[model samples]
Target: MTDRPDVLVVGAGPAGLTTALQACAHGASVRIVERRREPFRPSRAMIVHPRTLESLRPLGVVERLLRRGDPSPSARLHLGRRVVSTTLADVALRDTAFPHLTLLRQADVEQVLAEALEERGVPVERGVAAVGLAQDRAEATVTLRRDDGGAEPVSCGAVAGCDGQDSTVRRATGIDWRGRAYREEVVLADLDLDSDLDAGVLHVAAGRDGLVFLFALGEGAPWRLLATRPSRGGDAPFGQPGQPVPRPELRELLDVAGFDVAVGRVAWSARVRLQHRLAAAFRHGRVFLVGDAAHTHSPAAAQGMNTGILDAVNLGWKLPFAAHADEPDTMLDSYERERRPVARQVLALTHLVFFAEAAGHPAPAFLRGTVAPLLAPVVPSLTRPTLLAPVVRLLSQGWVRYRGSALSSERWAGGPGPRAGDRLPDETVTCDGMRTRLHRLTARPGVHVLLARDAEEVGASVVEDCPVSVHRLTSRPGRRMVAVRPDGHVGFRGTAVADLTAWLRLVGARARSADTATQPADTATQPADTATQAADTAET
Candidate 1:
């Protein structure tokens, strides 16, 4: 395969593509082979979370996504005729620069990623299936079969599997997949619909027939309908592949949900069972796994693709460095440790939502009639934020951080009280007189700046004295500046430059003396200037 590409990636999906792109960005040569001879046919995961947006931004495609996708205003939960709870998209995510979720086809997101990857000079190779892998400490040899019955072996220092849940990579490595299979299956469809509903709203209703969820696809496309299983036992959770649900059958189902059909074409439909699973380990010798290759969970929170893409991003930058680095080789372990807990959290939360709906919660009808209207005003609070700091902290994507990571050390001074796994907060900021998201300011594949009130004293001499563009932040500036990692964790706090010297040693970057950093002589602050060589660590 072209004289042995540097990295052999099996699969061209979001996970694999992201891995390839990230690896390329780090200056590693890569070869990605896919069985599917074409791009995705339709939008699968239609919702892009803010964290995913952040990941895409560094690749220079976020604005394109925003321009092409529909901006969903909020997430609403309703009972038959009343609304039980409503989370305004804007308010719920006010903590994130991208406060709202964008509704777009998964294919759309892939297209953007694909273009960006090509522009970066690493295009994916399609129509070739990776059938086997053989890896040694020195290199990983990948076997590929072309559509024309040709075979080839490509060698690389490392191999990353970004394949889906039933990933061949997981099987090839022989890692035990551990998790429970959900009992319920869901029938989902994306299609055109005639509606008077607002384009930015996600409507969820409980009907006498079952539970129904409708999300506006865009201005004129089809709406995504997720209906609960009917009592007749005909509508199982996961639909069979050969037997298709006819238009009339789908119409009847909609009618039972109290929605009047306006006669539109169905774009896509499928039945999928909910699964919560994870690999026992994400790393094995020279082989590693990211995205769905490592974990799978229910889609209640719409976090699967988003989380997987992030997995690609997080592992992407690290792999190149680790592949070339020497010694302990402990850096890769952090991937599993940091991500496993996140998977568990996603599984739990998604299961919670599914359980609530399955139990009929406060009953769908009750929610639609009585709860929805009452909660609509608060919907903004529930939906919009710079990142889904609360829910995502578990998944470690959005504002999530890992203070106790391999890269972080507790010995650093003036460290915040946040723990190893906490989501960093977002602050409004103005750089160059152009007000922009704090997240937007952080250069890709690098650290973010969290300028604390004491940042001038503690950070000035360390980061400020360096060539890196560290945003100056205060606890209560017109906005806050929290230094986030490439993976979006708080790497350093600029609150107190008094701790500058200690932090520099921990970050492993060479820096000038701390003489440039001076807390006012009259300033009465504790001697946070503790002498320690540990790196600065923080919560997500």
Candidate 2:
């Protein structure tokens, strides 16, 4: 009803809500639509990784999440009677503030995000579904169908398809959701257990039959139980997707798994078929695909929702700039280029975990009863924080970089710390008699410029001309200047003010004069439409 917003977000899940929140923070008017009249009551995605916590900090929802969620810093894997526990505290990266996984229900996560959106005066429009989409050079038109048999046409500068796997917007854009669904069916239930289980550690019980995972929801909430149906010839007993598992069958599975817990008060239950799929293209003209609409896979490492949240943050920061800029396509093109590769990497990782879980079913009885117990002590070392640094980095998503992105440039060499395209480390520093973290200063709505020692002598002119927050840190022993993008990734790093100014001008920074000597060296070859053309070619 508010005149067509600058962006239209389809679906009010975490991804859609995050997209809307970030777009609004960046000074863009946004409207979100969801087919459901009410918020989801059942919990879907539960584990909040450390990197996701960092991404959520800018939106002002990370503290709320931490307040409501329980911290899970370690995990215990039970192979028959043998137990192997590993703590994440030792392996947690030093640059990040959050060192452990937070466990909160999906519903709670969405509620917190919705409250934040409401505080900003952007309420989600419920009971409305985007049935069709079309776009031209100027704007995108979205066709909406209401539950009350009313249809409306809305126009906006861009459309963000944050809708789930069965995305209508993705279908309208003619992008293929390519992948195969796994044959194994997963059953999930939330219920109270009358047994002794540690609430701080994620408990996984593996046997010759199958695997069962127990995640403590919170203080009062029921525990979430996920089990893979034992293969008994062909097909699972659950008739269809979303079917509630019978109480008797649930008990039978627990009994078979050797758990001596009494199931009480089933709050909710569901059966789901996992899939590994990724859309061929994330953008089709003015409409962009995000979250599950862009990529979906097994929930092996709890990467689905975390990856989706990052996707929203990554695209959200760029939408407003692209919408209002003269050459908007350049900014829009980087969305796919930077995000698609991350999605591919996540899909591969989840697939690897899923197959590894499946491979554990055929272990001999002796391995489970005796040999597994003997190896349990050594198992923790195999996954120790020091030994598995690379794998842990991948799982935490801390190593995600945009080195190949058009928006990134590392022209200066011989830097001791982070480079362009790498995530800026969150270091603590004193500014104006107040101690603050680097991310706290740079995680605002615009670009951030950090000037180290001799900042006044190096990049004073560039800092004056650039429209970003300038922070001078005299305590650091270096002559370095770094510009961080809105999404917390370094855009440019160097010691010369002229080079910094040239790179800024190249990226559409406001320049005081046309004849500034800081213009890019390759300005002649790099046309404004070069990035746009490359994006077009890649999508096709």
Candidate 3:
């Protein structure tokens, strides 16, 4: 216990907790530290997209989250009483287990992750801040400062910077955080509403005055109200950063926007200036950046927390492989290559949406009174089910992939399906006597190989001392083998097992000769039957 843990995660938010949970699941000892003395109680990031839900299931917290959160099947856009547009239903998502967004408070998510970490014997160490960081070829050392002012250094095989925008770990690593802050400020408040708005749909309203977002926070929680307006000349009620909007001013803004809702109680409120930024690089030797530490942008589309969770999942599985000296550096290098592009895409998308919303200044009196009503009929077409699918897919992050990553090898050809660097599709298949899902079989710790036939016939072999699981699929087309990483992305796909064996060797998965006696003789072949049985019994 005194020795350095395999991974040290800074910031115990969703990103950090997810990294810890994934690391622990990968059989790596992990320690998570949070600067805050207690867990976050506010409902900061509230939407859990379907892709994120799919990614979290492997960490074992999705079911708990689904139980505590409300399913938002669709969203709606309103431009006052003149026009209202509803998004498409969940019909577009036939491959995913979760077809809708889950609305849960950020605090509840952290709680579920913390509980899971506890169950795995890894607890979040609160009130401990990483004051400094230093890394060498072998490990990274972090100096922690307790609330009482005592400072101590903890060494780890690697460090994950999941801290917020102002990250101490990032500063210690001296990575450049380049980005610009917006002139406008946003107001966020959780309010008890008296109106009869549907709790199952997100409502967004835009006017010449500004933009307003209404998100339901489950059954008992207060609804979240987010608004963005131009900053006033001097000290305004809500435009100033971190300022709390007075109840009277909040009600006035809503009334001006034509929303006849009574605000009973303000549970939480804050004004924040949006920014678009990304770290120059996500990795600095053994120290890597995840979540907000790597990128920050307007919360348009609620991509912040969800992207961070994906970052954790992407980097968590690679840490164990990179920790060993014998393993090739390609695994670690692929992390940045795969994730930085995603951050770039999310930042660009959110920035565009934020600015577009900002430009929707309050409608002119004439436009609101006459023009808007005349154009209301045409607005439905713009927001039709088919038209909204692309937006929904982007927001849900279902299309995100690592097609450009080094680990994505497509040397082997396959049928018309997901290729290397893409997420493994969720499918139901019967193996042995049980009917199970493909995701369930590969959702566990370590690398999973899905062979089209028997492992021995396909030449699928496990590397000595490498954590690999080979699962056989009797139904897949062709004689192809797909190796899925711990994070669920297809690492390699081909018809020949030699290519698979070469990739395992490249990632240092080959077994050592000295340990051959202790290893299973049919380690590669046995998984075929076991995976078939697992496929039958695996939970959907």
Candidate 4:
């Protein structure tokens, strides 16, 4: 190992591991350290959204994750006496390669990422904790405390704080964490149920009391249960945090959830006190917070772990590029600008969903018991694959865009494809005389230029300018040239080869000129919601 790694990741969760993986893949020397001695731990997150799978695909671990997780399962929603069956399987997710949610344990995800790191020769230094940090103009010095009561300071070009809510790296930076805890506590468990519930179907019920979900995720246990237990004001008697849930309590919960199921055994259970919070800042000089250290919210839409993974992916590829950037901090600033707003949006969405579904107020109760039952009949029509396209696009986080960030500068007219800052949506194309998907080109390490026609015009100068690669698509022939970033985002799109050269140079690429040309940015950028536009015409 080198004395000073280009990047130092301070935790070993999905975010930290991903940061290490992506940074290393992009030619950055990396060292990942975790406080937990054990390589793996049980995780609260179980569902990996489609967008997350897309982000993880380039890392070469999605197949491993799919092997351990369940995908495209049907769902049976029970609203009072009405049972509305729907299929989450193959619901209008044509824009993505993995169109369904992957229900796997968080431990399984971390294990896969950790093993991927090991294969890359960057093992996680367990039992080492980042206790102190100091950054100068040159590099950051992190004081680490090992398990054997030894302490030392290591220097690095940048630091990634992917630790969870109570993150030492976040605390070391003294960033203000602002948010509140919900009075409600949710009891989540993996159990063996002696009931006729279909093992391949997810069951959800919302009564006047609250909402409960049961899924056959097969992570440790065959059945996973999430029941909302609203707080009864002050000093309310409830079972302990990690205690075994008794049979009577299970019966009461099942009755409240309108499920006629008998619990055979509880494989594992925990009473989770939900909280909502966001760091006032995601970056403190060279110390950047990620994952739960940056944001936390209820698992209403399952954004917790997925959001952190995206955070790591968004920042990972940028760290190496920023090191040689003309304005290094300017490049890094986009991390906070692009991510903080996403956290705010998630907090608001989860808060609204939590309040509507589980709040103690009678208004929400009326909505659940009376309003929901009346609307149950229309649920099937709403969940139809064609009708469900919008919801899938939104919840899968396929709609997230960085169009407003400093990095995304659109240079062409509203194209028939994704705009700058939007993810380079996966599409079928002819690459190297072989039928393959578009991601096969962008998945490799470096900036990829997709040329629909002329391959000779790109020249060797562009590739030599930076970590750039050129590909001439034998399909999707048009007057289009799109430059995909390392993180699978469309950094530039235009009709002119000269303009593509200018983009490479503007983004810290010292383009040695075969065609020294410059063009003004397409200032008339598309509207804020690029995903909606892409979904409408993504197939083109």
Which pairs clash in model 4? Answer: none
lDDT per model, in order? Answer: 0.59, 0.73, 0.73, 0.77
- Model 1 over residues 328-398: C-alpha lDDT tens digits? 26556767767777766776777777665543444754654455556666655654343344654333255
The pairs that clash in candidate 2 are none
TM per candidate comes to: 0.76, 0.86, 0.86, 0.88
Clashes of each: 82, 0, 9, 0
- lDDT by residue for model 2 over 427-478, one digit each (tens)? 7764434455666555445566677856544333333322355666656667
- By TM-score, who's the top model here? 4
Instruction: Give lDDT tens digits, candidate 3, residues 120-188.
Output: 788788999998888888888999999999998999988999988888888888999898776667777
Window of ten residues with lowest summed lDDT in model 1:
531-540
What is the lDDT for 293 in model 2?
A: 91
Better of 2 and 4 by lDDT: 4
Q: Sort every candidate by TM-score, greatest first.
A: 4, 3, 2, 1
Worst 10 residues of 4 by lDDT: 518-527
